[model samples]
Target: MPAGTPDILACLKGRFIGIEVKKPKGGIVSPLQKLKIKQIQNAGGIAFVANSLEVVKRELSEHNLI
Candidate 1:
């Protein structure tokens, strides 16, 4: 868990995935979030920063991780 951050966790296919959701504008991922994403990847998981539900779907489809 990171300070002042929401639950940046998303799971798919029995794997741990970290997701930092943001708005369509001026959305920025914090440093702690970046670290968390890296940690998730380092732990053999997927991580992403998405702007919208469509963006999430797009990422999942693009990566074939859906």
Candidate 2:
């Protein structure tokens, strides 16, 4: 598997989704992480770093990905 890949990968509402899980506090995204997320987005996919379940819900809802 590729390094820095998201923890969760799935198709939601006909869209490719990637979600990287992190700590609720003091979570840091490395440069590699930024690159990986950008790669997914560059391919017209949905990707996000979520520190909590609520954040995941918000991202999906806000983007209408679900």
Candidate 3:
């Protein structure tokens, strides 16, 4: 994986999804990670930082992937 690759990568309904999982407490997103997330989004992919399963589910639902 690349230096800032997201923790989970998936293709749902043909849409690229990148998820960066952080601990619910005190988990920080590094600058590199942030940059990668932005890059993915800019390239028309779905990318986000998630602190919990609920967040991940919500994001997917918002994108109509679930």
Q: Give the winner by lDDT: 2 or 3.
A: 3
* Candidate 3 collision pairs: none
Cα-lDDT of candidate 2: 0.90
Location of the lowest summed lDDT over 10 successive residues in candidate 2:
57-66
True-vs-predicted CA distance for residue 34, candidate 2, Å:
0.8
- True-vs-predicted CA distance for residue 66, candidate 3, Å: 0.9
Question: Which has the better TM-score: candidate 2, or candidate 3?
Answer: 3
Which portions of model 3 miss their true places by more than 4 Å?
none
Residue 41 local lDDT, model 2: 95
Q: Please give the TM-score that candidate 3 achieves against the real structure.
A: 0.97
Over 1-66, each residue of candidate 1 has an lDDT whose tens digit, in order, gives: 546233566667777766788888998788887887787778888778888899778867766777
Give the per-residue lDDT of model 3 (tens digit) for 1-65.
97999999999899999999999999999999999999999999999999999999999999998
lDDT of 2 by residue, 1-66 (tens): 688898899998789998989999999988888888899999999899999999999989988865
lDDT of each: 0.74, 0.90, 0.96
How do these models rank on lDDT, best leading?
3, 2, 1
TM-score of each: 0.75, 0.89, 0.97
Best by lDDT: 3
Ranking by TM-score: 3, 2, 1
